[model samples]
Target: AEVAPGAVHVPDWLDLETRRRLVAACREWATPRAGFRAARLPNGGVMSVRTVCLGWHWYPYKYSKTIDDVDGAPVTPFPGWLAELGQRAVSDAYGAAVEYQPDIALINHYDSAAKMGLHQDKDEASLEPVVSLSLGDACVFRFGNTEHRGRPWTDVELRSGDLFVFGGPSRLAFHGVTKTLPDHGDPDLDLSGRLNITLRVSGF
Candidate 1:
């Protein structure tokens, strides 16, 4: 349970072996379920996209559709392990037995060419913190303030097996990835890109 004190970095939460396994699993998941579209900007321009979500696609940062997995329900609901992890993260951050059960784990994939602009994760019904895990290549994460998306920001290096948690006043903070640092993962992981799994309680 490592809290990102103003976007602090937690090295090796998953360790090398676990990180490798997670990367492989993510690649396997991204194969068939590709075609993650670029988000349309407000000016009618489309932002380049390499992200693929396991659940519904939030196009233009809005929930577009509900995906079914053979059955007619959502494909990737919250996993028990992930929810437990979220609880632990919250507890570790505040030193309290806070309950955080995240139902949506947005799996965002980023290639060398992919980068995210400043945005806030306010789509969830719960104001609880967001537990984000990084796998694959390392990237520079830019975290901004809650009111405005301008400067007075922190540049955090999100490497494989790193965890970032933001809540409270920082819950509505603006954040995005500036760039992915080149060749910053285990060679055996075959990480030509990066994957970010941010767990949240969408439905409250």
Candidate 2:
């Protein structure tokens, strides 16, 4: 479904097996070396959603090669296969051929109480499409306008295996997860929270 101009939401894009594999990969990436950690905002408040990054460490308003806020360790390398998956997602959604070589993956873990605020992903140098994959639980995704984070927004229920791609005019739109449903994940997954993997072109 086209949620907005240049923004597409493809439901159930990943099959059961694929979701399982991706979840396993997420577990590996969530290790202590480059694991999940709460992000502290510039206001001295911490974000509810815990995040971990690959290829580039994302601060509140910037991207870096190391996590200076944490232990200052280098982030895990972005996998080539994941980048390929992102390209395939863009092709499937937009029905066009383009070189979507994503260099960064921002993985966010949202528990039942975790929620993200409406914000624009403008930290990246590239205006390329942002490919997001959802897993484990369902959530209310709010896609707001580009002018501001106020009204005139649409709420969409994003379930496991769903893919959302935003670019072009919607690239700078304010979007966020309102709330996550508990115990709504596939029983086979055995995950207690929702996992969101967003692929981006850092252009660094």
Candidate 3:
């Protein structure tokens, strides 16, 4: 479904086996040595969800090779397979051959009480479309317009294996996850929360 111009949501895009494999990879990525950790905002508040970066570590408004918020160790390198998956995602979302090479990925784990505010992803140098893949529990994804974070927004339920792509004119749109539906994940997945893997091009 085209939620907006240049924004498309493909439901059940990933199969069960693929979701399981990604979950296992996420577990490995969430370990120590510049792993999944809480992100502290400039306002001195910590984010509800824990995030792990690949390819390039991301601060509030910047991207770096090291996690300045953590031990300054270089974050995990974004795997080539993952980047290929992202390219495939873009092709599937647009129904055409797209020239996308996502070098960075933000892996976020959201618990029951986690909620993301409406914000624009404008910290990158590239205006490439953001590829978001959902796993585990379902969540309410608020897709807002580019003007602001006010009204005229659409709330879409994003479940496991769903793919959402927003780019082109909507590359800087304000969007977020309002809340997650706990215990709504596939029983076979055996996950406690939701996992969102967002792929982007750093252009660095």
Pick the lDDT winner: 2
Comparing 1 and 2 on lDDT, the stronger one: 2
Worst 10 residues of 3 by lDDT: 29-38
Instruction: Please give, for residues 6-31, the per-residue lDDT of candidate 2 as tens digits.
Output: 99999999888989988999999998
Q: How do the residues 73-190 of candidate 3 rate in per-residue lDDT, one tens digit apiece?
A: 8888899899888999999999998888999999999999998999999889999999999999999999888898998999999999999998888899899999999988867796
Show model 3 residue runs off by greater than 4 Å. none
Q: How much lDDT does candidate 2 score?
A: 0.93
Model 1 scores a TM of: 0.81
Candidate 1 residue 121 C-alpha distance from true site, Å: 1.7
lDDT per residue (tens digit) for residues 60-132 in model 1: 5455345421223344443466578768766665667987777666777777878888988766667867778
lDDT of 3 at 183: 82
lDDT of each: 0.69, 0.93, 0.91
Q: What are the TM-scores, per candidate, against the unseen true structure?
A: 0.81, 0.98, 0.98
